[model samples]
Target: MQSISSQTSKPEWLSSNLLLQPFLWAMSWLDYILAPLQNLIGYKRMAYFFVLPNLLIFGIFILIPMLLNFYYGFTGGDSILLENRPVVGAANFEKIFSCQDFFKPNTCAEDLFWRGAWNTLTFVVFQVAFIILMSLITALALNRDVRGRGFFRAIFFYPVLLSPVVVALIWKWILQYQNGLLNAFLVSLGLTKVPWLLDANWAQFWVIAVSVWAQMGFFTLILLAGLQGIPKEMYEAASMDGANKWRSFWNVTLPLLMPTMTVVLVLALIRAVQVFDQVFVLTNGGPGTATLYIVQYIYRTAFEFRNYGMAAAASLVLAVVLLILTIGQLLFQRRQEAA
Candidate 1:
């Protein structure tokens, strides 16, 4: 057994392996080409060579699309092709913002767009709040010296591994009005059946709840890492000064965890603003567009209505909002660090 293990571990065995030979050959060829270039540019500048491939990919996939989307926002027509479209200036923006009462979406010319914006804002505010609170609590609980800690952690994080659509489908099955698992259980217990999806308010509530459940694991993991990175000596010092657990947590833990908490908040806010898949699968922005969000609005405008220009305009507006939020978060982080 020892001899067999030794033979398998040898470089000669690796070289002879069919599966790895192509990759090995490619690497050897790449190294051969890079050797001369490395000498010309020096080792320090060779970092650019390693980064060039990724930069090119990013430019092609991300940067080009963004520029096209921005340019498309200024044009109007039913056509998907950019070259044939006529530039309509800010007509799309004017249509969107040409509202008598900004608070009342019905007053807007593009009422559904405004409705989606309102719903997205509402969702982001509540979702971010609940996600932050729940994640913090869960992280604190998991970080403690508890029994079956690994099992509990795995259970909490398991949902995060599932795709968004899968998560939505699972929840939909559990929350269905007539034949859902929850409704069945309620019937068995002689309780009233709750209209989870049919009603507007209830639909919004369930969407937010399921979203929080599906995503809490990731934020909790981030918070747990932040908690672990904190210095134990600070807690010890607080204890020596006659501080209780709550006091120590407030003073030491919260302050130290602020940076990680900010990251979680920003990411959660962005995701909430861009929410689509779960809402689409679970509710389809239904019950009179009550749960409709901005991304869904953009999608419908482009594909369903075939108003590509309007979709592009709405997308640019969404991008600007996100960019502003990101810039604000960065400025706040810098101020915190300076302090």
Candidate 2:
């Protein structure tokens, strides 16, 4: 051993250069923190082992990134500056409002963004209303002891289960201008073939309709669960008081299911306003900018135009708007609860 040690100039510390340093240190830290408990209980009694990893993961993946995004939102970011860039307050936001599409001839006649914003709001407003009402009806219908209730539930849920892209593709086929299923069926019934995706008006309508179709299943399922939770005694009591179906729904059912309904409406509104992917696949926000949602515009601004700061700023604005809506919903719900 002396001869072998003398033969090499290598240091003794390098012999145990194991890759387990971090783990060993971590376990040692754990032991030090929990050493007092070892006298009173077992190793499993200390929840640190279970707790530390989850806390570590949450901090690393969620909390840190959320904090950074908030920071980035304020940073006047450029794709060239990449990360941790300097702040240029309010410039990004101003750009979005002031951007004039001067390159496009005849586009001057219309206020592009104001008009696009109008269309987006209309889509969101109508779609959310339709989805909530339709979902409620579907939930009520499926809540009964009718024949093949399970099958009907599955059928409703089926559209929601399909990938958004797949749903979009399916709807596209159905709504195709010439040989589409919809037009073919219309012709068979001695009706005219209609342009579903080619016209601005019709395109807007289908975008909303298909979105409602794809989403209704999931919302229906949610409301159905809420409906089931209402006690049968409530219905019987209402009936004993001579309330009809509509009256019972408006009074007993509505108030009792308000909590779930509140959640459904708020979520649906957020989703509807940020509508993309389905619209992306089905119409790409056009025939014109008829279905061009705010998100798509931001996406194009950021990635397509390499205006990272503007994109980030737009997203922050969208987030703020959504937060405001959510707060409104919460306040309304509180008022409802108080009433």
Q: Highest lDDT: which candidate?
A: 1
Local accuracy of candidate 1 as per-residue lDDT tens digits, 1-339: 988886776676565769688988899999999999999999999999899999999999999999999778889999888888999999998998999999999899999999999999999999999999999999999999999998998899899898889999999999988889999999999998998998999999988999999999999999999999999999999999999999999999999999999999999998899999989999999888999999999999999999988899999999999999899899989998999
* Candidate 2 TM-score, C-alpha based: 0.77
Give per-residue CA lDDT, model 2, range 26-65, as digits (tens). 9899887768776667667657756878999999998986
Root-mean-square deviation of candidate 2: 13.2
| Global lDDT of each candidate | 0.93, 0.82
Error of 2 at 51 (Å): 4.5
Tell me each candidate's RMSD, in Å, in order: 5.0, 13.2
Q: Number of clashing residue pairs in every model?
A: 0, 0
